[model samples]
Each structure stands twice: as structure tokens, then as C-alpha cells.
Target: MAGNQEPLSPRARLAVTAGRAAAAVSRAAGRGSGSVIGGKVALRLDPDLLAQLANHLDVVLVSATNGKTTTTRLIAEALRANGGVVSNALGANMPAGITSALAGGSDARYGVIEVDEKYLDTVARDVTPKAIALLNLSRDQLDRAAETRMLAERWREALSGTKAVVIANADDPLVVWAASSAPNVVWVAAGQEWKDDAWSCPACGGVMQRPGDDWFCGECGFRRPVPSWALSGDEVLDPHGSAWPIKLQLPGRANKANATTSAAVAAAFGVPPQTALERMHSVTAVAGRYDVVGYRGREVRLLLAKNPAGWLETFSLIDAPPAPVILSVNARSADGTDTSWLWDVDYSRLAGHPICVIGDRKLDLAVRLEVAGVDFQVCESAAEAVTACPPGRIEAIANYTAFQDLRRVVGN
Candidate 1:
């Protein structure tokens, strides 16, 4: 209440107050994990609450099928140089979360909000963010988001004729197609690890061939755009051919890619590359995505992979065949009720590997592992699975709800 950043009109103030009260009650009653319920109540009380508060803030919007939460946290941390900032780092990325973020006060000059892929068009219209980052788009929540291509088209239409600066990943063909028509844009080859989704060219709908970092469409002549920043092997290279070393505690090339794009956006807002990277290095985790937790007197490292793309990228970071990690999954609303997407993932990669299968969908995972000829055990509890695993830094990979369940049980 003290850090009310945006001076409000009487009507907006009433809505913010109502929303804050709802959030407090939810937290007190242990019914809601965040301000989502409160945000919804506020929106209903005042339909234009988002636009009313956003009018006074210079904002940056981050959209991605994956990594939106982590990338948003990175940008917000780097912008600490600018003073106070408000962001939805807790995974409340829909309209409700965005509204709740703005409703909470702060004179913070810049607001970095994570906009869900499905709601990018809706939130962008209200915030009119000064800068927007379109990270990679891949199939996720097919039940809710429809298709990846449809989401990209919506993004293109939403930003049409807008004055905001757009930063896009040139490595993802769909991302390139989505951001192509923006009035102003900066492209970054932020190192996409998943290639199966981008094999088909978005332009001609023809098969694409990747000879190296660039993909070419033989039919339509659409090729990878030359990027202003290139993320290669632990370093991001600028247009001047100078390499900025990437040093991070979070393992994986995907994180390096996240850092690369965040630094690029920070520079667009006048923050130096070195300074941005420095701030980002301090980020150890984002809402438990890659967090280490102490559970039952042992360390449990959590990794979340919602869909095929995320699973593919995460697997590339750590050895699977020999590492002996626990795999948890559940068919909850958070992780689309449909478990059909599991087939799209390459489970054969785990053939001959040892793994522990848990979560509500343990039967499904065990069956899949059976087909792949992988050696695995079935467990009902994450605690029991950890005990069965070999000692020292046991890894636990899960879908959305299973990951949250771990967070709650592990006391995060």
C-alpha cells in the first residue's frame, strides 16, 4: 500500500483496494497461491483497471511458449538499475496476474510484465508496452492455445501499426514469422535447442533444411534473418564481432539463450550489456523452475518440462541414460488434461536408461518406458522416489502440476 507507484483516479483506487483485499483474504485462508483471484475480482469491479494504471508506466512485455517466467525475472532483475519494478514472477501470467501486479503500488519507473502467449494480444493492447520480447513459440497446452502457428498469427496482428519496439528470436522460424511485420524490431539468434518444430518453414509451409545456424526454405526463399546478437557456445556475440562471456549458475544452453535475449532487451532500454549480464548472473531460480529443495533430509533438484519442446531442451542439458532421475507427471488443469502430448516426446532417448516414474500419471510413464526398453521403478511419493535414487543431488523432472506439488511438499 505504501509503494503505490501509479497515482490513481478515484475509480481505479477503489478497484485496486478491492483486489488487494481479495488477495489478502485468499492468502490468509490458504485458498490461492497468488493474487490471481484478487486480480479477477478487481477486473470485474473495474473492467478498465489495467489500462487505467498502465497509462503512467513505461513497460516491457515478455511472451514465450516456454521460459516466459524465467526471462521476465531476468529482465526485471537487470532493470533494478532503474529503481523499483513490478513483475509477475510467480507464474501468474494471465490477465488476472498482470492486473494484480499493477494494482500493487510502486513508484518504480519501469514495469516488466510476463504476458502469456495466448493473452499477448489482449495485455499488449492495454499496457501499450514501450518494448516487447517475443521469445520462441512451440506447442504447449494445445487444448487452450489452439495451435502454435495460430498464436503466432495473432501476435503479428496484435502488434500491427503499434509503436512499441519488438525484440524477437530469429532462431525460431515461427517467432521470426510472428515478429516480421513489427514497425521496429531487433533480431537475436538466441540458440534454439529444439529443431523438430521448426523443420517446416512458416512462410511456404514447406520443409526447411538447416545447414548450420540458418534455415532455408527451398520453395519460398525464406531464410534465417541475420541477427544483431548471436548466442553461441557460452557467449553472446554482438554485431561488432565482440563476444560477451556468459557465466551463470543455472545449467543448460537454454539458460544461456535466455540470458542472451534478456541482455539484448536491456541494452535496447539503454542498460549496458555487461551490466545486464552481471545482474542476470545473480538469478539462481525463477519460482522453482530449476530450484533445489530440501525434502525429507535430502536435496531434490526440480526441473519442469511442460511439453515436447521443453522436455527436449531440458534433456539436452543433463545426461539422461545414466543420470537416474525421477520423472513425475499429472493430468491437471495446469498441465492440460490431455496426456496425448506425451507421445510426441522422444521417449526412445531414454532406452536402456534407469528412471523412477511417479505422479498421477505414473502408469502412463511406466508404459512408455516399457516400450522404450528403459529400466525404471514406480513410486507413489516424491519422498520415496528420492530415497530409492542413488545418493547426492537427485534430479526430479516433472510436468506443471507435479512440479507445484513438489514445491508445496518440499516447503518452497
Candidate 2:
């Protein structure tokens, strides 16, 4: 592998020799075999190795507390529609995960990646994406990422000298504020329509004034203007029932933001706006994210709610009458060690409705439900919970781990 040269495929004949050598090194060093996703091994190799993998390709990095995966997929789809192939292995964001994607040379000229917030600085440092999309920053996995403000500062530092074209959401005060320092930044707001008024000024903690749905700091005088690109006009319709006719295939307000950011990124990459819209409109679905399924002659909707912000977005998407709703919580420290964040969620939204509780921490969710004044039942296991509920139209909300458990229960 030399300068700007694509690396050999991981499945190539030489891959066996490389795998054996890697296995020997791991064994001699007393390490476990690496984990795999999309049939590629994710390992922490030397940083210098990144130079050898996909040197000829331009990396497009998308980062956000929410919507990163959906947006990355959306942008990749547009690129593909315009005759550009893309390599985005399963929702992998870590540096090692990226290395794995490049292990198999992509047929496309561009590489679209959904990067995790904590790993953004590291990936940006090594990959130096040709373009970067910054989505809204909301409260999330405090145990893992600390404060959003801190993460913003670190991203700023990582992106300092990079020549990547930046496409950012103007609605998020944190994202807009960070974009102020970028070299070549293009602000993409959901327009005045989807602009949220309830936001605090990042600089002085002053009350942000809302001229309609748009927000600006009264004291500090920092205003977030509407972006040039948007999906809906000034009044964003809250799609309550089935998914709307938006350009994005995914449902929910958060996804609207994802569509907006992804479209802007595609345009920045020189994809025409009309072409971008056509490609985006062609998008259908992404895994574990608003992923709809059929099980035992019944429809099942699977959504991933990892943090409070993510939960809030997911909660608002369920509009129909509460029909046998099953809520699963994971107690394990790894899935979410403390599980204390449940208190922060607006469970009151489930108001006076029946909800079945299951998984490792059924009591935890039950107690929260009790506080919220919602009716509920508890089952020893997810299997019993699903079987206990009357089979008809069912709405299930489960955390990351509990989601997997429920999937097994439904025989998926």
C-alpha cells in the first residue's frame, strides 16, 4: 500500500496471510480475537495504517447526538443515486470500525461515515473527512460523553486545521456556535418552520428569544438564522399517525433534521439540489431505526432509544391509541449502567395508559410508570410479556439490550 492507493480487500487471498499474522500477534500478546460487523474485523491498528487504506477516496463524516446513522445513510443513498458508490459498514463510528470499512476497498469514489461524538475528534484527526456534517447536540449518555458543551469544544479543536467543508444545523445553538470558528462552514437550518424556540444561549445562559420558531439570544445578541435548505416550510407538520410524505424514508421530527443535514451534505459534495431531493425521496429504511417488521401476522415497529433525547424523539412518533404497549428497560451497567436516566424522560406522555413492563429492570420501569400515573403490568421475562399481551396491533418500546431480548421473544 502506497500513497493514495486503495488497500487490498479483506476477503482477498492475501487476507488469509494477514489474518493469520494478526492472530499470531494477538495470541503472543495474550489478546482476544477482534469483534466483527458486516463480515469485517474491527481492530485497533496503528494510526499510520489509515494512510494505506482508501488513500484515493474522500471521506465524508457525519456526527450528531441523534440522527447520525439515518443522515449518513440518506447522504450515501443520494451519492449512489448519482452514480457514486459508497462504503458505510453497519453503524460503526469508532476509529477501529472505520479502519474495518476501509479494509475492503470501496467501489465508490467517496466514503460516507456516521461517526460517534466521542470519537469524532479522533476520526477527524486521522481521516480528515473532505466534508463533515454536524447535527444538533442534545443531552445524551452523560456517563459516556460527559457534557455536550465539552464535546462541542473538543470537536472545534479537532476540526481546526482540516479543510473539510462543514454543513451544520443552524437550529442547534451549540452546533451554530461551534460553526462560528470553522474555516468553510455552510449553515443548514430546517428553516424558520422547524426552528425550536425553547433553547438556552450557550454563551451567557440568557433566555433565547423566539421570533416565531426561530431563536436568538436577547442578552448576548447571537442569533441563529434560518438555513438555505429545508424539507418543510415555516410550519412543520407534526406527523402523528403513519409516516408522512417527506423526502426521508424514516419517520419522526428528528429524522426531518437528519434529512435536512444529509441533503445539505450531498449538495456540498456537488450533488444538485433536485438530484439530491430525488435521491433522498428514494430512501426507504435503516436498521433498528424506525425499522418496521411483521411477526406472526402482526406488524411490529422496532426503534432504538439509547438516551433521553433519543427517547423523547421516539416517544413523539407514537401517535395512535395506546394498543398493548410494551416498555422494556435494561438494568445491566453496560447497556446503561446506572439506569437512573429514566427519571428524566417525560413518561407522563404515556398518561393513564396501560403499558407492560419486562426485561432485567421491570421494577425500575414499573416504578417510573407509577410515578407518571400510567397503568401497567410486569412480566418475569420478555417472552411472557409479549405472550401475555393480547395479540393484535401492538406497540413495543425497548432500550438497546431489552430490544434484543424482545426480538428473541417474538422469534425474530
Candidate 3:
């Protein structure tokens, strides 16, 4: 009994030492958000420890089916633009990662965290952000769950206790429904034409028809009200397409949706609408998510395809399949893990190819592309896939991962 007790005390002491060592190393490496830990990062922490860590954060929760990361980045930028210090390290949105991010910095007025769809409830319960931005909720990561309806349910639960002012996407039916309970919700709607993909109402099972790009319940006539800030346009112009424009740097309609949503949220925080728009124009792209770069003397664009709607939006952005597109799919326990959702993507939206396929799940993507009658060459690895394409011809590669396999290959 004495020997066992001796070991337990020593083991507990060692754990404390290890925790301190980790914190020291994290600080030395300039990591922040020491408070807001993510479940995906530290899966088995006891509730008390988790609560201790979270108590230090002034978290700003950001969730959406499509554009959380992009929108989160934009919000961070807007906050900075308006002379407020913000805590946001790219791609670190979970509780542990967000904690680490906050730890990296010491004096930020706000913490802008992009919350994972599944973990939204946990983070919301823990972080208790000053403000929550609910971007559009579309069908994403279908392999993780059966349907978007379930995600909507989880979101409703996550947002229930957030006394923070809510900025929601007025364009999405599912989001509008989920956030209906928030009294302080500021509805942000984009222009009518931008609401191209509104799904039907989950409550009444009614056909949700686009009444001039604004949504209306076709069967029940329940109107989805317009947003406070809306962007109306026929063609999304990336002025940077011709020249490196000093004002606005991003391209495509999906980007416009992201920029507009960012503008609205910034305005809600009292950043003037024009100031928000001006700041938005300064963003070129978010990394690994429709991020564009010059690689090997050719333009390389990365678009993350985790779900069907993301795929559709990516398809909508590119102009008729830029030459030598590379699509890599990897299976990770963190990122849905199953490739069956590949079937649901509108791969037919992309026509023609010198398309190269790569990843642990490359064969799955290859099979899907073949069945869909698209021409593609399967590569053994991501680097080889990039190598296979001649410089300048291979313009972009859209790779999926829960790990850095693709990033290591593309070197971006």
C-alpha cells in the first residue's frame, strides 16, 4: 500500500511538470489562447481542468457550414482594421488550439475563433463569447452525419445559452431557423441573386423556393426576411484579375459572400459599413481554403472540399475548369474519415481536365471521377501529383486533409 501510494504521488507530480513544460514551450514558441482548449486537440481532459483553462478567455465564437474560416479571418482583420487587438491564429479554431492561440498573445481585446460544426455546443458552453457570428449553414461534412438538418439541430443547441449579440446569415433558411430564438440577432442578408442555393424549410418540409433570390416558403408562404446588409450583383469582379488592385484583392462570388458577411459582422460591432468593405478588399485569400499562390512560376489555387456545398461553391468560382486541376482526397479520423460523400458532390460541374488525383483516398476520388465520366490521372502522392503537371499549366490544386500532408507537398 505504501509503494502504490508513493507511485501515485510521483505520477501526479510528473503530470504537473509536463503541463508546465508544455505551457513554457507554447509561450516560447509564441502560441496564444492558453485558455480556450479544443476537444479535438485534448480529447480526454476532465471537466474541471477544461473549465480552468476556458475561464481566461473572452471568446468570440464563429460558426458556419460553408465559410467559417474565411469569415473568421475577415472578422479578425476587420477588428484589426478598426484598431482593436484580436486573437486569431489561422486554422486553430478548436478549444485547445484556440487556447494555444490566445496563449500566443497576451493583450487582445477579442478572441475570434472559428468553431467546428460538431463541437459548436461544447465551445459555446465553455467559451461564452462576447459576440457570436453565425455564418450561413449549408450541407457540409455529410460523411460525419446523415444530413444538414442534424447540424442545424446541434447549432440551435449550441447557441441557446449565448447571451452575446448574434450576427446571423439571413440568406440561409437553416441558419435563420436555428437563430430564430436569439432576441439580439442581427440578420445579415446578401443580395437576392447571391442566395442561389437556399434549401427547403426543415420544420414544415415545405419546398423552399427562391422568391427573387430571397427565400420564401413555397408551400406555407413563410417568408425568410431579408438581411440587414445585402450585396446585389450579376457578376463578381475580381479587379485583381487584371492587375494587382490596391483596394480589393479576392475573386469570385463565394468570396463575395464571405466578404459581404464579414462586412456585416464588422458593422454590427460599430465599424462603419464602408470601413468594413474597404478592409475586406484588402484580403487576397485564406490559406488552404480557396487560397491562391504563385508556385513553380504558375498560379496555384487551393480550395478545400470537405462537403458537397463546398465543392459546388468551388465549381462556381473557377472559370470552366482552369488547366491542370489537381484534386486530392485524404481520409482522417478528424475530417469525417469516410469518402462516401464524394458521390454527392457535383463533380460534373467541372468539365475537361488535365486533372491529377492524389492522397490516401486518391483511389476513391479517382473512382468517383471515372464513374462521373471525368478524365483524370491518379498520382501515387501529392508531391508527385504536383510534379506530374508541367509548370504554368497546372494552375491550382484542391486537396483535403485533417493533417498537413497536402500542405507539406504544395509547400504553401
Tell me how candidate 1 scores on lDDT: 0.83
> Among all windows of ten consecutive residues in candidate 1, which has the lowest summed lDDT?
1-10
lDDT of 3 by residue, 1-412 (tens): 0011112234333433444456566667665423332322232333333333434444567887667888788777777664544454466666655544543333455567888766777877776666787776655544555466777777777667568778777777877777876667777654322233356676677888775656778787666765565555522222122111123466566666666666666665667555666676667767655555565566566767676666766666566545677787777764667677688776776667578887778788888988998888988876677777777645444535622566555656
Candidate 2 segments whose C-alpha is farther than 4 A from its true place:
1-45, 191-199, 233-245, 331-334
**Predicted structure with the largest lDDT when compared to the true one:** 1
Mind sharing the TM-score for model 2?
A: 0.83
Q: Cα deviation of 187 in candidate 3 (Å)?
A: 1.4
For model 3, the stretches where C-alpha displacement exceeds 4 angstroms are 1-20, 23-58, 82-84, 191-198, 218-221, 234-247, 288-297
Candidate 2 per-residue lDDT, tens place, 1-412, comes to 1134455455443443453455456656655333122123223323354444546667788888777878888888767655554555456566655665665554557778888887888777777678899987766655665577777777777777778888887777778776667798877755322223236777677888877657789998988855665556312222121122346566776777677677677767677555665677665666565656666555667667766777777777887565667788886653656777788788887765457788788888889888988888898875566666666666678877787667666646
The pairs that clash in candidate 2 are 189-227, 193-234, 333-337
Against the true structure, what is each candidate's TM-score? 0.95, 0.83, 0.79
Best of the two (1, 3) by TM-score: 1
lDDT of 2: 0.67
Q: For model 1, how does the per-residue alpha-carbon lDDT over 1-412 read when each residue is reduced to its tens digit?
A: 1223456778878988998898999999988654899899889988899987777677899999888888899998888876677788787989998999877635666788999899999999998898999889988876776687788889889888878889899989888988987998899989777776788888778999898777889999888888998798888887678888886777888888888888888887778778888888888988887788876666778899989889887777666555668889898888988887788888777665467899999998788778767788999888778788766666788999998887787655
